[model samples]
Structures are given as structure tokens and as C-alpha cells.
Target: MQSQDVAPRPTPASDPVVDVEQAEAALVEHYPRLVRIAYLVLPPGLGRGRRVMTAHALAQRALPRGRAASPVIPAQANGRDGDPGYAFVRLRVLRAALEAGGKRRGLPKRSQLPPLLPQVWGLKLFPRSGGADELALDQQLSALSGPARAAYVLRGLEKLPDGDVRRILTEAGAADADAALRAADRVPARYELLSSPEFDACSLQARPTDLMRRRQHTKAALAAAVAIAVCGALVALPGDGWGPDGAAAPVYAQNPAAEAALDPGRLVRVTGTAWESAARTDFSAWPARGDLVDDDGLLRRALAVWARPGEKVRLSFTPGTQTGGPAGPPQLLYAGTVDNARVVILYDGLRIARYAEPKDGTAGAALDFARVDGASGAEAAAIVLDRADGNVRYLTAPWVKKAAERDLMKPGAGAMDLTVTDGITSPLASPATRAGACTSWNVLQLTDDTGTHVLSDLGELVPARLTTGRPAKEKDATGSQALHAWAPYACSLGAVRSQGVRSVNAWQFAEQELPDGSGTGDWACTRAETWRGDGSRTLAQFHTPGGAYGAVVAKAEGGPACGPRDPHVLAGVLWKSEGGHWYLLAAGSRDTASIRATGGISGSAQGHVLAVRAKEGAQAELEGTLEDGRSISGLR
Candidate 1:
């Protein structure tokens, strides 16, 4: 068809505009191309099925509301002879696609939702699979930001030059068009792959969703609806029917065990002096002590919510921890008012569940869960009482006679006394909440009859215990030498926040003297062990003689290196001396008989230390021989 075949009638010079009729004509002629643009620019997290539907919806909705002036920009010279109607419709599609992938200032846009008109009922439609090259390009595009992806699509699919792409992006509300172009340049230019079936939303592959799963879901949904109706009727009858569960969800089914769990009277409260004679000292020995311990109403509400939390409750869980309701009546650890909220702590032998509600009402409640199945010793010595204003309060063990705050970065500084009232320590600055440069790390030091132990909060309900020494003979981090060992690597603890860490042990494995006689560098390995008996992280750190903090040379997650199972660890770092020369510095544990470096650089040394002259940015592989004649590879 000719260009003028669908053009609207000529208008006056003072009121030149593209009306709805002209825009619709351009959209109908170039529907496939416009849909491809939207598909490529839409966020990939929505999956291929939704991307196809949204792409079609955006292209169909690209018509102008009425008569609108086209943006004052030169159109690309590819085709259509710079048609104003095509440009107007293209800009609308591009703007809507970008908005769908990002946040807007005012109300949520319609493009963000599943397209209402262009959705399929039982069939899921997605673009056809392409070759490896197309798949790689799709992955690379997915990694780019929305604006960057739009820039790439406009350049490749639309065959527009960089200048046109930049102008179109700016006119479409992109904040930084140059930045988008720069980011697009990082992707390899495989422009031909843009026409592959993998990106063509017009020609799609259709498949029916799992029929069996849908059937099961429909049956479950109907059952739930009936149960909800029954519960609503019972609630309307009043009397003793599920009275005020706070923010908890409505009960769908009636069961004797669940009812018993919701009863506040069934909560196990320990005696104050139980730990003195108990065979095992752990959270089981924690005594019930809170001003609201006698407040039956608050306790009942807390227990009810713990059994069945509602949608309004804010819930958080540590890694690998489950959020299911309690199996039976749980133990009461603490129930009282803290700061602006009424908090309650409960332990069900496997997990520690914390429930908190507002003081004025039950709205805006929060619940948190952390796995503490086999906790004892220092690991079970303290429970977080309250966390507010970047500070934390802990209810220490009954045996803890004194509480103090110490900075792990400043080991030489004396510990500051903190007031302990009813086994609760005053608020201390939490290192997990600190931002920017981590110059200092504060830890809680609790002194009991055994000695002193240190605990650091890792953004969880329970604090992770700190220790230092060899893997076989690890001890509490209270000695001067142990404190010094933990100073340089303390800030590195931020890497393990919210990871359910139970304890962290720092071991100084080796020390090497610099080749240029600059100074001695200490090699230390820190291992963080989680409560789930897995996901242990080990770091090999290098600390120079006069450096403020140690640098992590090598690290491994869930590896046997630096642990008791495999006490031997070897690591290397490329260091530059004050004399302006580069060298490969490597060290192994004390039991190592010799160490060697290969691949890109070669060196061999006796007695667990090796320093070889090398170039900067050179990669090398290390091997070590233990005293028992076993070989070990360097930590990656």
C-alpha cells in the first residue's frame, strides 16, 4: 500500500497534527515490528509468556487519544519517509514499554499489569526457542537495565543509528540517554540475531498449562471458600468463637491440637533457678521474665498469631528456616513491652519465633523466625529482646553476671560497662545496621562463671558466637592474642549477615616475611559456620604489618578448607612492595612442609611460605605438601 493511501486529510499550517485515524493506520501497517520492539524492551523477569501478551497490548494501545502533535525530532531514514503518524505511534509504544519495566511518579500504570484484552485462557504462549547464539543474546539483554535494553532494541531491531536512538530515548522520558548508549555498547553486536524467532512475539509456540495441577488447585480453592464461609458464620455468632487473634489469619479448620496450641495457659514457663541444676544449659533453661508475663490477654493474642499469622503481619525468616505454624504448645521465652511495641518471644525446640504488635492496637504487627535446633553454650546464651533505632537489646542468660560492649576493631580499648536489668542488657550499637566504611565493629561481651565470651549480631534474632585459635583447639575470643587476631578481619563479618551464622572462628594459619624485607605479613583464615550444619564460609585474609585491615585473598562457601575436617589451607596474593616491585606471596598452615607456585609464575619454598618476583595481574596455581605427605590445592 502507498503511504498516502491511509494518510488523513491535509490540515492547516498552524494546526499540523497526527490524529487517531492516522496513528491507527501506521500501527496496523507495522504491528509486528512495533510488537517486537515492546517485547525486546520489556523486563525479562515477567517470563516469555507475559512478555508476548504485553507486547501486543502495548502495540494495540499506541494510538493517540485524539489529535496530538508529533514530537519535534527527525525520524530515522530507514523507511516510511519520516511519517509523522509512525513516529507518534512508535514513541507511544516505547514510552509505555519503558514505564512497564520501571517505577513512575504517580499511580501505577496499566501497562504494568497483565494486558486485559490480549490474554489467553488455558493456553500459555511464548516465543519459539532459538539456537545458542540467540539464547546468549537474550541473556545478555536481560542483564541490561530497561533504558539500555530499549536503546539496544531501537538500534538493532529498528535499524536506527546511535543519534536517532539517543533522541528517541530522550523524548521517551529516559533520564540519561548517553548512559543507556554506553551500557548498550558493552553488549556484543550480533544484530542479525534480532530477527530470530526467539524474539518474535508475533509468531509464538503454544502449550496448555498442566491440566492436573489446575484441577487440584480449583478443588482446593473451592474447599477453602466453603471453610471460610463456615468460619464467618461462626464468627458472627459471637461468644467464645476465636476471640481477637490480633493480626492472625482466620481459622479455616477446627482441630484439638491447634486449639490447644493457641491457649496461653499451655505455654511452658521455666523457673528462674532452673539453669543452676539443669543437666543441659540452653534456651530450655531461659526463665520467663517480663512485666506482661501476667497479662493473659497479650499472651493469648501472641500465641494465637503464632499459630496462624494473617496477611497483615510482617514476616521475616532466616535462610533455610520454615515459617509454618507451631506443631504444638511452645515454650514462652519472654513477653513484655519494649520501646513502642509489645513484644513476645517463643521457642518451639527447633525455631525461635518473635511476635511483636503495636502498643495502641494489633495493627502493623511483625513476626520473625530463626532456626536454633541444637543451640547451646554461647550460641544459646543471648536472645535479642528488641532492635530499634540501630541499637539492639539482648536478654542474656541467667548465669551472665555482667554485660559489656567492646569494639572488635579496637582490641586494645577497655570494655564499656552496660547496665543489665533482669538479665537484659542495655542497647548497644549493632554493626549490622552501620553503613558506609566499616571502621569499627561493636560486639557484646558477656562474663559468666566460666569466663568471658563475645557475640556479634549478624542481622538476625540470635547473635553469632566469636572464637579464635587453631581449628582443633578453638577457644573463646577473650584473650589478648585472640582479640588481636580478630581485629583486622572483623569488618568482613558483614558478608555473612542474615545468613543464620552460629559461630565464627578466626585462625592465624601462617606468617610470611616480605621478599624485599619490607615487613612481615600475617595470614589468617576465618570460618563462619551456620546453625544448619551446612553453608560454612571460609576466608583466607592477608594482613600486612602496618595495614589497618586485612584483605581477603581467597574464600569458599561450604568447603572443608580451614575447618577441622581439612585443617590445611593454601592461598596466594599479588602484592607490591614499598620498593616498587610486584611479587607472588603465598602461605600455608603450620603443618605444611613446603609450598610451590605454578602457571603464569613459578616458585618453590620450604616451611610453608613462598615469595616469588612476578608481574601484576598474573594468574597462578598453588600446591602445598603437608607434613604427612598429602597434597593440597590453593583456595579459590
Candidate 2:
């Protein structure tokens, strides 16, 4: 279980030690977030010196396994940058800190646990100026046990859903995710401190303000002007979608009432200035935006999406028909949520073949730079992202390599023209334009079974250069899937080729060395009644000497999987830990179903070593031994 320091590598390019450098960089980038989480979990009462050192050590120990458990933070959360990945790792590190000692027992008694304050978590939801004393907060928190402390901090402060909180507590060495949830719910009136308004209710209905939009940005005026588009009367496009009399009308939502229903599944149209957003630096408070990319490349912006708790929103991206152009083949058209700050990105990996068939080394019409035939080729494109940063600045192509020059609006008013090619008419513009006024185009076009609807301010989609490789596999029709939304054992995650067998995302280990030579052993204990029920399931996650964890599940109520009641064997759980998280040493779950039959259960992970303990309910019972000579079963 001992860790050996890696030998130093001088240079990344000269030495070419990519793996080592990458690992080191990941640890560095995530260290701060990890420390913050560790501090929350570390038992209080230690001086500053011990508290800081312990959290850092725990974070370091967790780095490797953390990486293994979840290699990539899923791009679906639309959270602040790296929040998902760090959130995943934070739980593991906290759990390791809780289960550090050789001895495992009841939730740290109030007398044994560290100080915690409800206000610390409350500020995350609603900030105020009370500034409660550290000592007073500590005294208030001292009344709570370790599990309660964890629940208050994680579920209450982090704003994670109840389910996510439970999963984290379970992995942190709680007897089970559900039992941990119950214990957390036992925290008196804690939920009231974190309550906010209408968080869970979502309405796609268009309100009056939804029809209003910010007006033209003038060089002379520092601030933006607000304007409302006339909706009562519709004006016909001069050349298209007009009646014979050349009359046009403003379009309205096909079913505004359907959206007003406030159902989770119905699609709501977003247009004009209907929705407002905010920005935050760290993914913690107001956790929010992506930087704008110009001809000069990506530039950091002091802005982001500011979403309130329980407000779940997804941007719509539906690609149109492919007209063979002289542009590079499309590699990826992704609605980004990670790394790039949750912006839409389309990477064209220069796949020339995906365009229409070519002729004489030219993509023929697809690449016809000189287009008279309305053909297709590798055409240039642009994106316009509007962030609510006091000013209305859009994320668009940086023509002339100058971010400032990507001005979406010229003085006066006119549609912002996106010139696809030098002489070609701007590819994406409003159907009509004022002689001197700016014509703004809404980029998102939503096509449902009923009809096609347009969303304003989502950003315009045009061709762009894509250098990165496309996703290895396309996302399923169901939409962005959670990396670990369901327990890896509960259901499959995606078309991830590496899914199912063992979850290898990110993890870190806390090694606990076992006595030498006595590696193999048997537990000597009596068998308890093998009571069965669908009432609840008890699962135990055991930590390896190296800080990695493996789990075992028993479909019974009010009983521990490992303790002193029934000597339960890990019938289908894995017995090995790799890269800091438990891995299946062999095909145990997929093996014969008879392995868990009513008779004596088979198998053991005794060699890895475990310190399983139980927290008694209000009515404490005699902790009993199991048939296994060494294993114990009870509530953890």
C-alpha cells in the first residue's frame, strides 16, 4: 500500500514523458477544489497545521484512483468548467478521509466529530451578512456526528440533488447510499436553510418580456439600448414567405399553452430576451460561460451562464441538409458543456471524403470556390454567442483576428451580415433588412412534430474549422447521457466501448498495509437468519489498502452486509482494486446466477483487507459475527 514518488522528468517536449506530465497537470489543476472538499470532510478539532496537511495528503493519495474511476467528466452537466469531474473526485477523497483509521465504528459521536456550521452550507444557497462567529458555528456543528456533518455540507451546500448526495456518502464509506440519505434527512430543518423559489418548476411559455430584445450597439453609446419587436402585426419577407400581396406576419409559438403546462418533457420555445443569464468565475457560487473565439483564437471572457438551482436548460442544435461545399468534412457538431465553458463547437476534422463525390482531385461542386451552381464545398462559418455581461457581446468568428472588430452591430441598424466568402452574400442573415438599420438573425431553428420554430440569441451556426477528432461514438438518440448517473452496475452508461465491466474514470487511493504472510484467511462467525425482502437493499463499499473501494449489495432491510450478524460473502462483487477504485478481478457478476443461491455464499476479498463497522439505530442490538470466520455483517 506504500506509494513511491515518480522519478522527475525534465521537459515535456525533449523527454516526451506525456503521461507523467499529464498526470501531474491534472493533479495540479484539481488540487484546489480537492482541498476545499477535503477540508469539509476532515474531522474538526485539529489545529490549522494538521487540518491543511491531512486534506492535502488525502487529495494526493486520491489523485491516481480518481483519474482511473472517471477519466473524463461527462460533457452533459452544463456546469461550470471541470465541476463534474472535480465533483466526482471530491466524494472519493472525502470518503477516504472519513475511513482513514484501521478502526471502523459508529458515525463519529458528537464528542468525536469535528465542528460544522449550518451557515457554511447555507451561504452557498443564499449569501447574507450575518457572519456568524467561527467558535459559535463550531459549537453548533459539534452537536452533529460525522455522517450528519457530511450530509449538511454536501447536500445542503453543494446543491447536489438528494440522490447525488446519497451516492457520494455511500462511496465515502457509509454503510449504503440509502442509509446515508436517511441519516442526512434526519438533520433537523436543514432543508429550510437551502430553500429558494420555483427552482424545480420549468416554464417554456413566452412572457411579455420574451418578445423584447436588446437593441443595436452603437460605438458612441457605451451601454446597450433595449427594444421590442412589433408582434401584433406581421411583416412579410420581401421575397420569401409572403402572401401574393407581399404581406408578412410575425410568428408566434405554435403551442404556447403546451409550454405553459410546466411539464418537464414538453419543448418550450426560447426567443428574443425571454431568458436572462449571469456569470461566475469559479463553478461554485452562481457557477456559470465560455470565452469568445476570434481570428486570433480563444480569449477568456469575464462572463458565464448564471443559472439558479433547479433550472435545467438545454440548447437545441439541429443540423440542416448537407450541401457539398469546398469545406473540410464535418468531424463534430457538439453542444459543449465542459472545457470550453458550455458553448457550441463544431470541429471539422478536414474529412474531405464525407462531402459529395469528387472529380479530378477537386471536390467538384462541393469544393467549387467559384460557385454559380449553388453547390457545396468547404465553406467558412461563424457562431454568435450573446452573454449577459452588462453588455451584449456575442461569441462569433473573429474576422481580422481582432476580437473587438467582431462587432455584431454597425452604427444605425442593419442585419449583422456573415459573409461566407469574399463576394458571396452573407450566408446567414435575417430574411429582411432595413436600409440603414441592423437586421438581427436568431440562429436556433427547432423542428418538432407540429412545426418549425426559431429561438433567438442561441447563436448562429455556420461552417468552421474543426481540428479535433470526432467523438469515438455518436451519442444515442436519448441525448447526452450521464457518465455515472446510474450506478455502473444499475444500467449501462452509453455506447462507451469501455463501459460496464468496471468504471475507470477518476479515483485516488489511501493504502492500508496488511500483516504479511497471513494474506489468506477465513472469518469464523455464526450465521444469522437469511431474511429476504424487497423493502430495501444494503450495500457495503470496502476500501483497499491503497484507498480504492469495492462494493457488495444484499437485498435485505436493516442489516449490514459486513459485520457480525451473518457471514456474508461477496458472491458477485469484485475482489481487486486498480488505479484507486475497485475493479472486478474476474467475471463475478456475469458468472452463474447460482453463486448467490440460498446456500452458503461463495468467494472472498479478505486479502485486500477491510474495516467494516455499523452505526446502531435508536434500538441498539448485539453486534453479531457472521459464518465467515473474519467478515462482519450489520449496518455500516
Candidate 3:
């Protein structure tokens, strides 16, 4: 039922009419509280930065445009009780905030976009991170509908009674105020948390953008502006008039090389069978396969944007990937319509540039770049075609004969066949989009002439290859033993999202027999290698016998502890046995000759593994000696 079906509560026959000045007074007096309410009521999907800005914008715009009649419903007991001015401004803010979050049939309202006046160009502002309790509350609120969130905020934050909340929600355009109130009741009564810094948009932490990258962009913009001015002067001198290129930056210079790079005809297109006869198989050999490959206008716009993206374009680059124009004409990998956007993939020798625009027009275009300089074999097997609604579609290599989806957490469940049309696989659930506890991870498994290989989406243009075995001798994670070995640590992949991860390898390091005669437990280390050759993450996971999942005992970022360079890992966990006995179980790689523990608990062992009886909740430090006499500390 629509909110209009519910009539607002009746007020006194004579109520004070509120003018713009009175509403402004109430807004200024309760600015912080009102902004907090708006922040809590705004949609969480807009991200913290955007939500903070939108909340302030809505609160600031709460005052009436001109003198107006006060609503029949009176204000609640929120300090400004019975004040018609406060009630009027509060209703205005609530309506606009709800409208901003609600879906509409046409173009978005001004409230949904970034505010024109209050903007921080070189810095990002957001609320400070809170503890787990705040995070849980935020997640719960995020799951609620926009109207439900507003109801909860009104009831908890404004301390409004049920009748007042109903009236406010109805006036704020909730489709069903009763349903929204019912939905809000499901949330735990954590009213005190409503005033915490976690939801306060007035108090925010600011972080500057990448200074070096910003400087580079500034230099490029200045150079482009100068070139555009010269080109304008030349055009004014009178020759042929140049027309506008849709959604692309103006031509920066009139040089042969630069002009060729932007020419649609100059884009390199590999034949369908090129990979079959090529000496080396990589993205360079993949044939362009998309419906828009011959669309000159689209190709020209894509090429032009890659050369010099306009200010309006949403540009993103993988870590360490240079966001600069190509040196020469780039190879065209694919150009087609994916969902609502037309996508074009171009690859230079060092990087891959993906340009996408709306199918209807080029108004909201985006360009993304990723480094793929030395990718080959399975590493170059798939490129992300599109990501929408927590799902991702992939453009597989031409050599791939079959595509399937496998749940890494359930290695024995087998794989589900996926339809492949023109080298594009059907959309699969992406692990990168998952939040909270990870119960399952879906990975793409592609079968080629050689063997099957698994790849995972890490929120990048390219999916990361998965491998198993010893560090240097890692093989494809397709074998039964390898799959089982990786099953326990599959959820650990969440730690490497958006890190420009190139590949991930899982290696079983050591196993320890339980002291209480329980089954043996396994120890494994998972490492994520990035395309930039650094910032790898290593996790030492412990999988107890019969446990459904592994526990990460230790983790380190940008270290060689669990990598090929230093292929030894030592970690300990306080595990409770079925008999209710506590033990400190420590295990090192096979190469470790001795292990010792100190600090809170003391223990020593001759072999690579050790199990010591210890008290619960005890802390300790571990050190190990390898057979080569090199000393090493435990993974932290």
C-alpha cells in the first residue's frame, strides 16, 4: 500500500506557519543531529564518502524555499518538541534523503549527485572506523530498505513515538509506513549507538589522494590544454572545421604518432586462428570478438579516450599500472555490448585499457587500465568482460574449449557447465562482491588442450590464476589432491581483493598429530602474487581434522616468509581437543630442523613439528632453525 493511504495525525486547529528564516534557525541549531539522522538514513551502497557528502547536502537543503505552512503532524520529544519550524525542516530533510536513496523511473534527482558547493577535490572524507559492534549494526542497517532505515533512525535517533514515526515516514514518501516500522522492529534495540561517531557525518577523517599520481595528472592536463589551445588557434585560422568527438578529451596535439594511436583503422585486430599458429600464446594472440568491432564511431571514441581521457570519464588503474596513452597503435581484443554498456578492450605491449560507455549514449563513460606486460599461459587465459550485481562475466582465451563454475569450498561437489558464446562465459558469482562471513567461493574453471585451470576474480580486469603444491613447483589447481588441499583455505582469497593480484598458490606446509589421539591436523600457506611483483599476502592457515573450514593462524603482507624466496613457515595455534584439553600445537615446514616457543608459553621440539600442553588464551613467540642453519621467526 502507498504511504498516501495512511493519513497523518491531526494537529490543533491553529498551528504556527513556518517561514524560511525560522526553518533555517532550526536547521542551524540542530545541524549535527540532523546530519547524523540523514547519514544513518542514506543508502549504504553509495559508499561512505558519497554518503557523508550526501547527508550534509540533504541537511543543508532542509530549509523551505519560501514561507510555507507547517505540517499537521507535530514534532516529537526531540528537545525541539512542539516547534513547528523544527518539524518542518526535519520533514523536508527526511523526504529528500529518502528520495535520494529511492529508485526513480527517470534521471536521478539533484540530491543523488555530489553536492556542487561542498566538495573536497584532493581528499576523501569519511567517518572513523568503529569496532565490530558498530560494523555489525551498519551491516544490518544496510540490509534494510531505505524507508526502513529512516524509520529506525526516527524512532531511535529522534526518540520519536510510534505515532510520530508513522506520520514522519508517511510524509517522507515511504511506500508503506507500517511495513517500514515493522521492518525496523526486527533490528536489535541499539539506540545508544545512533549517537556514536560511526554514524556522525559532521566529524570525519580525511585522506589525501595519491600525491604523485595527482601531480602527474595535473601535468598531463596542462599539456593537453596547451595543445588544445594551439589546435583551436589553427582551426580559427580557417581550414576544415573539426567536429566534437563524443565523450573524449579534445585532441591534444597534431603529431603523426599521436594521431595514428587514435585512429580506429590503425587498431590491430588478430585473426580468429592467430593463436593456433602463434609461437607464443597470450592476450596478443586473442582475436577481437564483439558485435561492435566494426563500429568506427565507437572504436574512435575508445581510442581517443585511451589517449587522453576527459575530466568526466571515470578512470581507474590497477596498482603500479601507468595511466598514460599508448606509445603506438594498440591491439583490439574485444568490442561488444555487455549488459547496458558497450565495452572496448585495447591492449598495448605493457597494459590493457578497457573503455566502456552506455549503450544509449557516451554520457557516462569509464576507462580502466591494468598491467599485463609479461602475462602468458593460464595467467592470460581470461579477462573480465563485465561486472554487475555481484556477478562477473569473462572473456576466455580462444584456446579454451570448455568453461565451468566450481565452488572452491566444496571441492568434491564437481563443477557446473557454463555456456560459452563467442569466447564469453555466462555470468558467475564473484567472490570480490561478497561481504561478512564467507561461506563459499566460486571460481571459474576453464579447460584447454593441455588441462583445466582455475581462475578467481579479485576485483580487477584480469582474474587471478590459482595453483597448488610447493612454492616453486606449483601446478594448476585441478588435481583432486590439489583441490582438496585448497578447499580449506579458499575463503582466504577474500584478503587479496582489489590488490592487483595476478595468481594465488596454496601449499601444504606441515601436519601435526593431535596430542589427545585425535586425527592429524594440516598446516598450509596461501600466497597472493600481484602483477606489480610486490605486496604479496601470505596466510598460514590451520585446518583441524574434520573441521569444515580452516582458521588463519597467522598472516603477513609483502613478506617472503611463505613464498618461494623463503619457503619455510612456522605458526602455532591454541586448539582445544574433543576431550576438552588445551594444547599449543606448532608446526614448521619440512626443512625446519628444530622449533622453540618462548614468552607467555615455553616449549621446544627436535623435529619440524611440536605439541605442548598449555593453558588457554596464552600468548607466545616462535622461532625455528632450518636444516641449513638459517634462523627464522614465526609467521605473524
Candidate 4:
């Protein structure tokens, strides 16, 4: 699995220079995929420094003779483009190794690979999962280290056609290129052909010049001095502004305003809704760091590292009810102890100057806990807690930047943990009880015999219900049992009384139905109501012997019959202004982030068809924006 143990690769019949040229030819074809693989393999960290260096050197050497004269960064190797060349390089390296009689060790046998690479689970077919895709592809190159990751990425994700990956790695390591290529046989067989010069060259050579033209055009256009609105829907919005030299501009926008600007090119972002989107898009894996702790015992050691010779240190801790009375914020104990320790009282954890703990033994401090609102300029905040024996528990001074309060807040909710300490007796660790501290945004997790649901961090269910819950049909209508949805959508039951059904058919929650009834997966139905788009008039009835009549309508064109042939179901649409027309507006999915824009015109479908209308002059505008600035409209 280590880099050193890779299988050896077969040498080309020609000299090393000729072989390098052949490899370059193959590499040029599939370099994009290979670069992606490399990034996946050489994950950021000190661990990858050597490997990154190794891969870069190899890539430099693999450049074809003429191309080397003016070495330009491969378009595929750019960070924004996902460095697919690394993936292709991985494929090529593995292939070269296989042909060179490299050890077939570590690679899952063909049988094992099929199961390991199950299309349903392993492929991550979701269109938005480029990060996940990178993870999945790199998972295969587990045995190899940083360089191997680069190599595999080039061949696999980038689908590079040649053993240039092996050449690159070998060249970087200053080892025999043929032997190094052979060593890559440690990878699986599926990736072997990916590196073969013949295979890679064929693919590269066969690629149409038109594609090259398009790629070059895109690069040039994106790099151009001006921003051209290619199309309203496809226009590339510069992040901050156009870069000085035509590189992709970094766009910066915030909140509801920036919600609509998410586009194909603005992949990694740092501010506003773009921040959340970027976090979701770029971070395929979870954080590996540990939780933040403010224990005084730990703080003492932390202080040794954080304290400056002349600089003052402040320790903060929250007092619990068991501390007998208000010690103020639990931070008083740490302050008192630091006072006793004779450290300079330059500031308190609240960043307050010269504050004193209450003298009446009121158990807690009277100082406000909000003093350190934004005092993160310091390296660490020293903290101390009281022990049962009256001895200072310990101290902990965590790095301020990484220890920001935001780190403590849980996702989809918030939490505040304050430890009560009475500089006098052992501070009760459990005094930190949940009381008025609970906020509306706070999450209350409730699990019972039936199912589990989370109450919003905010104590009010009305807000959670209003935001996450469905609108009630009526007083007599069944109230929606709260359904938990990690995704944007969930399947819930809906019903209209027979009388109500006469006017608007309210379909009950049925089991999931696949696009094609033939058999696949079912969709989660959140809203199923019968309404016409004419903005007026409700239907009186449906079953009138003539295939049912009313404001309700069926697909303008009936879809395929019940069978396995159809891969997906038809997307539902809304009737537009035109007659007998239903335009495809959106693709439905449980996850809002996964929903694709089907557009008003695509395939055979058009606009929405109404079943019935609520009344005359009834119109609604829904609030949701597509990746483009275009707003998705329907309900107001």
C-alpha cells in the first residue's frame, strides 16, 4: 500500500526519452482526469508535502519535447477545474505498472472490485457531489500515498490515457521510470488499461478538435478582460470582480441576496450563502478535530504555550446554580484564581479591565460574561475552575482564532456550556443545568416509541413549524404529524374529504413511486393538491365517466407503460399562459440542493397543467432561486 511497494511497470521498446514522449502523448489525452485524482490522493497537510513535490516534478519531466519549451500549467491541473489530470495519471501509472509485471498485490481481485465499486452506492451519481466523487475515486487508491493519489486521479477521474502519471512520479523520485511504472501494478486491473499509451493516445487523438475549440474558447473567454453574459441563465458572475488577467473572478455576495448567484463555475466560496454552499460542496469529509474544552486543568498547560512574558492572561468560567448564588458568569472563579496567582489583571476573559469577583461568597461572580465579545486578537484565553478541595482545578488557554465561539455552536442549532466555579469549594461540574439558557434556535431532540423529531433550538415550535412544517389544510383537516427531514423535502400524508375532493383532489401519502412504475426508487411527496393555473375557479368533480374531468389534468403526453425500460419518471409541471400547455419547470428531489433545473423547455414536457383553481384572481409566488439569478415562481 505504501508508495515504495508499488508494482513495476513495463518499459517501452524505445529509449527513456522516446518512452517519455509516448507517455506524454498518452497523458495529453487523459491528463485532466489524472489531475483530479492527484488532488484527491494528496490531501492537504504536511503528510502530502513530499508527495506533492514528487508528482509536480514528474509532471514537469513528462512534458513533450516541444511543449516543454513553453511550459504552461495544464488546463485540467488548475485547482478550480478539479485537477482531473491527476486522476488520469493515477490510471496510467497503475496501467504501466501492470504491463511491467508489477505486483498484483493489494488490489482487490476482480470479484472484490465489483462489490466494492457498486454503481448504486459507490458511484455517488448525484450531480452535485464532485467532492464526494473525489473521495470515492481516491478511496480506491488507499494503498498509495500522496504521489499515488495524484497518479490515480490523473488516470481515473481525469481519465488520462497514458502512463505519464508513472513517468511523472518516477521522474520526480529520480528512479527508473519503467520500473516505477511497473511498481504501480499494486493497483487494480480496471485502472491498468487507463495508463497504456496506446489506449490513452487513442482516446486523446480521437477527441474531436471541436471539443478542444470549445475548451480553449471557454478558457480564453473566462480569462478575457470583460465579462460577457453568455446567456441570462448561464452567465458567469465574477465572484468579487473580473481578475486583472481574465482568470475566473472571485465573487462575493451575502445572504438572501447571494442565494441566486450559485453557478457551475463559482464552486468554492467563502462568504454568505456562498459560504454554506462552498462548505457543503468542498468538504466531502467531516472535520477530524476534537471538541473545544475550557477545563482549567488543561488551561494551565495551554497558558504555558499561550502566555507572553509581559502580556496579561485572563481566565473565564461560568458558575452553575449549585454554586449557591450567582457567581455572575462562571468565569469569576478563573478570574479570582488568576488574581490569587498574582498574574497581571490587564484584562478578564470577558476582556473587562480590573473587574473583581463578589466578596460575600455569593458563590458566583457578578461580572457580565459578554466582556470578551470580540477580543480574539490574543493568542489564547486562559481559564481556571475550582475543585472541591478549594485548589484551582487547572487552566486551559485555547488558541483564540480556532477557539472562536462559532466553533462551539452546533449545526442546525446552538448551545452554550458555562461551568460554575466558586473559587472557594470544589465547583460542582454538573451545576451546568439546562434552564433559561435554552433559546428558540436551540434544538430539542425528542425520541420516542413511534419516531424521533427535533424541536428547533428556538423554543418556539411555531417558528419551526412555520419554516419546516407544512401548512394545515383546515381546522377539520388532519394536521401534519411533524416529519423529520434531513433533506429539503419529505413525504407526508395529505387528504381532502370526499366533499373536498370534489373541488380539489388531495392525494394521501402513498408509498414511494418510481418515475417509471417499472421499478426504481420512490419520490417523497410533500405537497399533493389539485389546482388549476387559470388563477380562478375550482373543479366540482373528477370521475365523470370520460377519463375524469375537472380543473385537474394529466400529462399532455402519457408516459411509458409500467415496465423496467424507463430509467426515470417524468417530472411534473405547471400550466403556463399558453393553452393546453404544460412546461417543464423543475426537477423534484427530496434534497433541495440536488434538484436540477429542467427548464421551461426540455425533452417533451413544457409547463404545468392545473387540476383545479382555488378561486378567481388567486395567484401565488413561491420563493426559491435557481443556480442562476432566475427565481422559481408558483406560490406566494
Give the candidate number with the greatest TM-score: 3
The TM-score-based order of candidates, best leading, equals 3, 1, 4, 2
lDDT by residue (tens digit), candidate 3, 450-492: 8999999876789999999898899999978989999878877
Per-residue lDDT for 161 in model 1? 72
Prediction RMSDs, each to the true structure: 19.1, 29.1, 15.8, 24.5
Model 2 alpha-carbon miss at residue 130, Å: 10
Per-prediction TM-score to the true structure, in the order listed: 0.65, 0.22, 0.66, 0.23
Error of 4 at 117 (Å): 33
lDDT ranking, high to low: 1, 3, 2, 4
Comparing 1 and 2 by lDDT, which wins? 1
Give the range where candidate 4 is weakest over 10 consecutive residues by summed lDDT.
457-466
Instruction: Give me the runs in candidate 2 sitting further than 4 Å from their true place.
Output: 1-26, 65-84, 101-130, 176-636
How do the residues 257-290 of candidate 2 rate in per-residue lDDT, one tens digit apiece? 4332222222122222221231211101110122
Model 3 clash count equals: 0
lDDT over C-alpha atoms for residue 40 of model 1: 93
Better of 1 and 4 by TM-score: 1
lDDT of each: 0.80, 0.28, 0.80, 0.25
Residue 386 in candidate 3 has what lDDT?
Answer: 83
